[model samples]
Target chain A: MASEAQSSAPDNLPLVLIHRIPPFELSFKSWLPTRFRLLDPLDPSFSSPQTQSLVSSVRLLLCLGPSPLTSDTLDRFPSVQCVVGSSAGLDHVDLATCCRRGITVTNAGDAFSADAADFAVALLIDVLRRVSAGDRFIRAGSWPAKGQYPLGSKLLFSLVNITDNQTWWLFQLGGKRVGIIGLGSIGSMIAKRLEPFGCIIAYNSRRKKPNVSFPHYENVMDLATNSDALILCCALTNETHHMINKDVMTALGKEGVIINVGRGALIDEKELVRFLVKGDIGGAGLDVYEEEPEVPRELFELDNVVLSPHRAVATPEAFVALQEVVIANIEAFFANKPLPSQIELE
Target chain B: MASEAQSSAPDNLPLVLIHRIPPFELSFKSWLPTRFRLLDPLDPSFSSPQTQSLVSSVRLLLCLGPSPLTSDTLDRFPSVQCVVGSSAGLDHVDLATCCRRGITVTNAGDAFSADAADFAVALLIDVLRRVSAGDRFIRAGSWPAKGQYPLGSKLLFSLVNITDNQTWWLFQLGGKRVGIIGLGSIGSMIAKRLEPFGCIIAYNSRRKKPNVSFPHYENVMDLATNSDALILCCALTNETHHMINKDVMTALGKEGVIINVGRGALIDEKELVRFLVKGDIGGAGLDVYEEEPEVPRELFELDNVVLSPHRAVATPEAFVALQEVVIANIEAFFANKPLPSQIELE
Candidate 1:
């Protein structure tokens, strides 16, 4: 961890503890006072003396990545004014304990919307075009000679007549059914992006979102059966786990494509593999997997699927947004201002 | 082949010798009233009598793949009118001999444009996202239990202060610079697709065409140097071969990405491997290679590059277009009408 620049805050304000992440370095340097320690408190072990130090000076705690915020850990930060999570999802942070302690909690809301949207589209195109497969085919020394290798298929071919059609035609995306699960910022952005592509969007969410163009479906099965493509952009929770199982897979179109940019636990991985292998549905593009890092080898061999290691919001823009939001939340707590991105805890 | 769907053409007219390749059958059921044969002309020991029978029957010879068209071979088809090549590039067919014999030639123009464009865009996105590298990392089993792999850089984060300024905001085209070479139909479509992502389109061609909105660079060197991402969509002829050699490569940006959907001969492959190894360009995506089927094995080891096995036009739509166009030429010749897509033999 780098040394704190210099404190810009008054002498009476409680200190904030933030773990230094990449782009966060720039935001912390820009917005916060020098005295704040952007250090990893999880170093070696969280000892009693270190806990006492945190309790003595820290008025706010900033968290990023997968670091845990247990009640035991938070108890040491006695002077902590608030907890700010630098991510839209707050699964890692224990919100109930913070709420009980009367500690304000905020998050970097909607910061990753563009990154997620861009990646979702990227994954969709990648899978449809078989980009990864092409790369592998070339790398494996099986590249065919001229007039030997097969040409790629076009997306429009699936929509329009290619034979005996003399007239130039554009594909119709309008009236094409698209389903989105979890209508959060990422999903909403995806819906908006699809508008230009001419797909009719439907979503399944616990609550209907107002001021959206897409229609909402109460049942995941209904959405699944009706859509040409199903997008899983929802967060994973106990209720949401395995939301897309064998039944949902059966409802999708034979030529339909599925894209997942959210948590993998929301999908039944074994079923997805089975369905994909049997061509139960068309194809799938996944950025997240049920098992992280260890993507099933079978997925790689399939021509109808595209896979990316869980990195939907891993763009530079998202990182910068994350940094800015985290610093703002920390600064607000120090100056007694309302936190920018507030979160509710059970 | 499948007995020529009963032709009704007069016996006195120049017989059209249509040799349809076996296994991958060409549907000539409704093509025309013509004399056709399923001749294995590609066989090295093909009999001269069979050739003579073809030459005597048809004044026009339509060849699908690269089978040598010699005067001696055509002598058998004395009444043959002309030769129509099925593909775009006339590398396989002898254009000079066709011109000398007063034989008109034609090819399927713009048939693979959309497929090629779609592929170029897919490669660009894959290279930018490091999707290929992520796949390699997981397969290599270097994944850590937690935070073991470094977070790959995103397209959006490279911008300095996009949040503060709109100029920088537009700079993230899906989030990067996209440079195109040869603003032909495929190139133009690529630019159009990228327009939604706010890409700054620039190109270098032999001469600029009219009505194009994007900036044009007269010099290829300048285009290569200025572009953060480069795509080669130019045609292959005397002038284009080895155009992207060492000098042009040197001009490209450090983080530049290259996608070649055009002819493999357009780029100097030896220079490209050297440049990639030296990290002159951040990454590359290629569908065509200098030597067909025999791509440099070193490209496999490089995590930065993505290679496709010349399958850009292998799509179902493109294949259907190819079929329709080939049939059109045959029909036009028999009907004594103008060919839809004529290729002038200079």
Candidate 2:
């Protein structure tokens, strides 16, 4: 049965246009060889005559990871009606153009939500408890030399140096006020995961969601003001780009932590660096950066920061789930059926 | 009111013997002044004159962090009726001796449970998700150079290297079977936290616990055979010392992860190091070692291991809570009331 499913003949198979940058192509071919035929516009061997027929007849477009899907690319395939976004976040795709063309957009949706939310919680605990930093400390052989990690400050460990002992405290997960920037599927899942940690869940979204009991902040500033930690879970849109600016960082304050699993550019990267370096903010746990694969050099030395290489949904299971979703969306589109993860454009 | 509480005239108050080594002294004195007078025989100025009189009258002894409480130490304070343990783990205290002498023992039970459980979950996620390793990768500037940090083998990342790709997979916590060694307070809390992550929880304790629905294994080997990970949360005692030996490690297999937040001696350190170095086990996230403050030098170079100083309950809040519990227990002992965290010996 496995061998029979691995069909490679595609002379008359339904063609789907694959969009991706150089060295960043999707490997969905092996998953569904007989289900559909994928045509790559970026392929160098595609000479004119047959390419025009193939490109003009394609009705579905598969947008690969972080690849820009523009109107010009869409214009080549006038028959294209649906763009299957392989990522949970569709920031790179031109949603406005898709709206104008009446083209439907589908996403991985809940396929990556759990993984991303799990990562958000992981980063939160890792930062709050200093998991990664503690590992680094032990790896550097600093445990015996430094006496103890002292989660808050070294001075707090020595009873002799403690001045106002009653007021002194350290980081613990219970009773922490965490404000989420987005309360979508991933954000809600993050809230669910944090519920048992005894975290106070609040959120700031484009608009307040209905039937949800978490306190809503009208704006990011208000959310930051009330939160001990601000988790950026919103997308990177024109309005949301650099939403977490200097004022927002200042509002979060010196004792606040920031965990970002959303798209980069959601925060002002330079300002965040300055605040972290100046000890103006407490700490940050980042899985995405404004310029990913090129994290700020300043973060390399900061113990308060945890830097990841934009891999919140890079798990093999997520990759498989995404491919299945993309295939199902295409099959649904051709049959005039409701897509599994169709996104309504505003 | 605050000044009235900080009384230094501990002279004539009810005397309690403070049992601790040179550096491991309890700071409970400042928390409850004017309540009790502590007699320390270890003090250089604790010369014969008043020491004998004070030692003879003392009925309570405070055992500070990890300081040995052998029968010999108990012999020094023959009049002591109860030992107040300042930590959650009472392995250092001679519980058998206390039982034989008909002396009661109280510990910091639920006080440190939450923090330790939180740390255990943090370590588990950190190990399985490669949180620390990912941080290290980004810090080392390998993100730009290397494409991504594969949670499993790097071979799984490249589709170009696909050979028997169907059987090859990566790690995700959703469906993982986690076997906990001890389903005590800390272990139960760890299970509660992991429930949201969709993990399958099972356990092995001294015997089957009452009212628990999770599957129970009679021995460590059986638990290891069925688990994707093993979390050690049981106390260190004669039966538990090196309970996770070479046979247990072999049973856990190459894809298994070990998270130890209980005690160092829970697993044989040298054997653990050998297993980790040979990749016989998948990974480990350790907060304690067999010989802590001196981790195996071999672990320093392994990516699959995360080493931390034995500071699982070193949070400031835990410290304050512990101090309060110790004071409460001492107060209850004098009032002939039930202690908050008194241990019953079999």
Top candidate when judged by DockQ against the true structure? 2
DockQ values, each candidate? 0.19, 0.43
Classify candidate 2 by CAPRI docking class: acceptable
Q: What is the TM-score of each predicted model, taking all chains together?
A: 0.79, 0.92
Worst 10 residues of 1 chain B by lDDT: B164-173
Q: Compose the digit string of candidate 2's lDDT tens values, residues A1-346.
A: 6775455457567788888765565555465646677788787645567766688788898887768888887887898888988778898898999999999999887878888888899898887778888889888888778553333233222334444422122378888999999999999989998988889999999889999999999999999999999998887889999999999999999879999999779999999999999878888999988876789999889877888777777666676677678878999987889999998787
Query: Candidate 2 clashing pairs?
Result: none
Local accuracy of candidate 1 as per-residue lDDT tens digits, A1-346: 1334233334434456664344233333442444454434544444557544554667777775645678887886777758888666666677778888888888777777776776676666666666776676667665553234343222221323344321111222334578989898778877766664445889999989898767889999999888878888876767889999899888885666789888777889998888888767777888777766667777766766766666666656566677677777776776778778887665
lDDT of 2: 0.82
Q: What is the DockQ score of candidate 2, to 2 decimals?
A: 0.43
TM-score of 1: 0.79
lDDT of 2 at A203: 99
